[model samples]
Target: MTSEAKETGSGLTAELKELCQAVSEDFAMLASLHNKEPDAELLRLLRDERFPEGLGLRLVEERGAQAVAFMQRALSALPDQMGQADLDELAADYADIYLNHGIQASPLESVWTDDENLVCQDSMFQVREWYQQHGLMSTDWRIIPDDHLVLQLQFLSHLFAAGKTMDDLREIARFMDEHLLRWLTSFAERVAGRCATPYFAGIALLTGAYSEELRELLVSILDEPRPSPEEIEDKMRPRRVEEPVEVKFMPGMGPVV
Candidate 1:
């Protein structure tokens, strides 16, 4: 790698480490929604409007709105249903969209590009190679072929949180720009449009919100500017794109000790 590329890679890796650290906290709070039954404390917290934190609460609310909007439009598109049949059919239909219908490919920049391997071409491969170089390997849950989105975010969060070198920040920023930010905004919007429940809707909104924050941080590091909340609006606009230099990983890589 060139000197500049090395610097950028290290910087970005550090940022990803930081983000990976936050994943635990973020997921801990968000996963509360999955509780099978709510007790008095949970009920009280939800009723008091104090369960979700500031940004999280806002994200949740936006998701709720998006969900309702999607459901309303979807309901309008379908033939009329009886009162009892309405919710069951809607739920079934919504589940079908994600599970049965084919989803876009993962870990492929080409999926997001109209052209062949545009931004950060083979950059993901570089990342995979980087993982091996650093003595890191994908976990059982995060297999090589296709890692889950949530796991990827969590890993990045922790990586960025612990890693603070300038070299690490740059690499992570580029990764965020070329990979995560490049597609998450549209994905979130599409998810919002498709979901029929406030629970799922909120997840979509939260995804976009987090992506915005990550993009700002990445840009700030790349340009040597301080990222602010106001700077995140730029995510909606297109900017100059960069291609990742090719890097290779040996087979049967193991996790960093």
Candidate 2:
């Protein structure tokens, strides 16, 4: 290759790496926000001008722009000097949305995807299998199912940070298409509509938009077309046919045969 070509290739590699790092950090931040109630440290971080500026820059598309605007508005609603009362209110809102049994919005993939709207269902097991394929496992699956939003976001962060090749990006794209993208938009809309605090509502919108943008970014980087939602659904649907089982009965319950 020409020296100019080599320089271009190197520059592109550097740019891709920077992009992955930024995306990884963004996922980690979102995971942290959903993992627990906001504390003083988190509150301070949100209020920092750099936070919004950096996020706004990263989220430049139309959907992402809306998310950034909502988040900025929410942040602006916070007190300049946060007090215990402020923290308590935020905590309560968090609990109402994330911790309550009758939560307005659930943060589990199964809840949104399952027909019965239950947790710890087939989707959770499927997600667990995906983690195992990656040689990764959640620290406590009992407490938090494998398909929980926080864990999934953390997994994406891990994937982006560790991904270095086109194949790795492909895997990330596949995982997002198969899992997070399936229900994230619905979850985001629910949270945005029902959450008591504007912060979480903003976060919900941001997370949804960011995931969409990130998926598009991956498509651009990999130079591959993303499958439609219907295509993904058809691919994921079960195609297995079970064999008929011979009927056996207890002596007392047996019919004349």
Candidate 3:
């Protein structure tokens, strides 16, 4: 590659890292807001932006689609507009779905990963390693679990700040390809049909969108040596449920042959 090409590649990589930071920060803010009810000003903004006239409506609609897709798997997915009673009901239902089904709906590592055997290298398993390597513990202060998307975003945030070497950038890129984006697509697909509420449904849709953008940005940073873009397909495998898996139940956690 010419010196100019090298400089361009470096520039692209920097842009990709910045994109990752943007998406991560967006989700981190969301995770915080999810735990707390927004004040009147925020609520007014949400309502206005959600209405037909707001200029940024498409972004909201696109994200809404992702959320509904995620929730429609198990429940009667609805639109964003709902009364206070509906909101309460939806929240309660979501809580139950999360509690009763647990891993059945979303599996943390240990599921679909055979890291213990040392013969396979699932990206999800790699994320666990990354967390421990960075000394990110799962204490109560952490709002999300160890493997949640929000936490992964936080990890990337830390990486972006401490990044000083090309090796650091490469490591971060590897983490994105192997871990965060690797399993999240499949994970989101599984979640799409699990909920009935439009709110979470919107979340799922936006979640997938966010995941797609993040993955593309990371892969772009990778700059494949020979393989063309056409060769790459979706990064996740389709999940099948034989029995009616309960909440919290995860697949592929047992011993690998």
Who wins the lDDT comparison? 2
Error of 3 at 190 (Å): 2.4
C-alpha root-mean-square deviation, each candidate: 14.3, 6.9, 12.8
The candidate, 1 or 3, that scores higher on TM-score is 3
Query: Which digits, one per residue and each the tens of the lDDT, describe model 3 over residues 114-216?
Result: 3352222354445656766765554532343455555565676666545545566677666665556555656556555566545544444555565555444
Among all windows of ten consecutive residues in candidate 2, which has the lowest summed lDDT?
1-10
Cα lDDT tens digits for candidate 2, 1-257:
00111111122377787787888888888898888988877777777854556752287899988888888889888887889998888888888877784455788888877778889987899988878766788888888889999999988888777777777788889999999999999989988887778988888899999999989988887889999999988886556698876776677797432
Distance from true location, Cα of 232 in model 3, Å: 13
Q: Of 1 and 2, which scores higher on lDDT?
A: 2
Judged by lDDT relative to the true structure, which candidate is superior, 1 or 3? 3
lDDT of 1 by residue, 1-257 (tens): 11111121333364445454564355444333321222334434543553334322233345444543443343334333334455465445344433343333233333353246343344345445545554445454223221234434544544454455666666566556545566666666665566554434444555556556544545655566543323533532346688866666657874332
- Candidate 3 whole-model C-alpha lDDT, 0 to 1: 0.48
Ranking by TM-score, best first? Answer: 2, 3, 1
lDDT of 2: 0.81
Ranking by lDDT: 2, 3, 1
